[model samples]
Target: MRAALAATGRVVRAETFRLLRKRRMYVLAALWWVVLPVLVLLLARVLQVTLTGSFVEGEAVSVKTLLQGLASPFGVARVGLVAPAYLSPSPYVIAVALLAAAGLGEPRTHRMWKSTLVAEPDRRAVLAGTFLTMQAFLGVLLAGAFVFGAAFGAIGTTFLPTAAEGAWGRLAGLYLLQWAHLATLLAFASLAIFVLRNVTLGVVTTFFLPPLVEGLYAVWRATAGFEPLNRFNALFQGLELQATLEAVPRWFLSNNLYLPARTSAAPLLDEVVGTLQAVGEEAGGGPGGAQIASLLGADLTLPHAGLVMAVYGAIFVTLLVVAFLRREVA
Candidate 1:
């Protein structure tokens, strides 16, 4: 057992080295983690400013205030849209998938798997290594993106941003749920790559085609009046994370901040009330809904969302390991 763990560790280090050896990995990392996040925050801020005319609604609002409002549903300054776009599952997942396809797929295509197996010998270790490296790569990107996005969110405000409690835990759940979502799909994509030996085909089957086909099928299903919508909904599963992320943080902020409405000194501004009430209604929110918003993300509970997606991932990943062990390197 200890030996297997040690072997897995070594393989993980080796896989990490292989990924870092590719120059494009760094480029993609910067683009997705840094560039894309910053761009999204700036663009969201600009949209808010163009319409509302402030970095935050009040120039005097603290930097902490902006960070609080971020990832929350309040559109007072339109800061909350970043989380969904950051985790859009398509563009972002495709970026990571393209890397996985190009990096891992090409090695198989070139028949390098033969030499790799000869060197490592234990197929499970190699698989574990690749999986860990991908998640580690993604972890760095997720953490860096959140930090950069939060910092960027505070750019035009006055004081430093205050990060909050168990709130961080909720956001962590959001990102981890994203990790599971992407991890599941990427695992599926890797299986497809191994089976077909074509990165384009593999990724499209797992990532690209599912969403498109699902959308069309959903329309057809609606037209045909299908009863249950739960079947095969994994491909389109990030909204629960987005809604939960937005909902919980807003709860935290409302508790901590001194919005005039909270004090009954003033009613909610027309825009703020409209946006919150509209989105909250769908999330099962209403008067006093903000306090209980943490109960569910959008329409689904986290457990339901997690189970629905994780079950498929568990099956695909098990098959992936088995297939790798049986695969012919030559």
Candidate 2:
């Protein structure tokens, strides 16, 4: 037992070092830091111009308002994080697929499995170490995104909202839920790699299959009236959370779990829109209103989304581990 644990630790360490040494790690970092912030900045500017008709040089109120819209916990969780995390072909999903393929499938492609098996001996420990390394890498990526968002908020607003009152608890909950969602993505990608046993095939399938399946499922559900099929899709399950009806089944994977903050922010958004409309009316612009419902849709009180995502993640992990154990390295 002791030897197995020691071997697992060594494999984990080696895998971590290997991942960090990859050129793609630098590319991922650059996207998170440089590209994401610049995109946010451009989005803010566009919103400012649309809302207020002109960008005031000294006054950053428009920018701040736009930032508030984009940075709201609700918008960030649903549209920003959840959408990209679950939606197939997204940069986040593709990056995770690539990382998982490189981590687990590369050994097979490069014929390193025999030597690795020789070094570790125990296949379970080797698989466990790879899983741990992938989890660690994903955790770091999510943490880096959080830090970049904080920096972006600071740059856009004079006073970033502090964790006063119950804000800290809410923020913490949002982070945890988002982490859980991303972890599910990681497990799914790992499962694909283990099943395919080829790096390129695994990455391509993981990147493309979910969306294709989702599209087909959507058509079947609409045309065939098969609502139960919705549960099988992570993306569809997420969208169901936005349903306005009170009777929508409270699924464990709905986006509602992390978007309560968005509900609270709705009134503020309405007020901002009202203000913008008043200014526009005074300027002789045509009748216009900020469609809050269109922006955020209806808020549901389902708490089961987190639980569903957790269950799916466990299932994916279990399957991946089983496949890895049975796989012949030689």
Pairs that collide, model 2: 252-304, 252-305, 253-305, 254-305
lDDT (tens digit, per residue) of candidate 1 on 1-330: 787788889888987787778777778667655565456455545544453545555565543444445422221112221333324463445655765775469778777888888888878888888777777776676556556555544552332222332244445445555555567656777788877778788877766555564455435533542224554443234344424433433232112111211222122334455566678688884444443332212233345545655666788789888888887876
Total backbone collisions, model 1: 1
User: Candidates' TM-scores?
Assistant: 0.65, 0.68
Estimate every model's Cα lDDT from 0 to 1.
0.54, 0.61
Clashing pairs in 1: 64-161
Steric overlap count per candidate? 1, 4
For residue 180, give model 2's deviation from the true position in Å. Answer: 2.3
For model 2, the run of ten residues with the poorest summed lDDT:
245-254
Off by over 4 Å in 1: 44-89, 158-166, 226-298
Q: How far off is model 2, as Cα RMSD?
A: 9.0
Q: Candidate 2, residues 46-84: lDDT per residue as tens digits?
A: 665665645563455654445565644322322334334
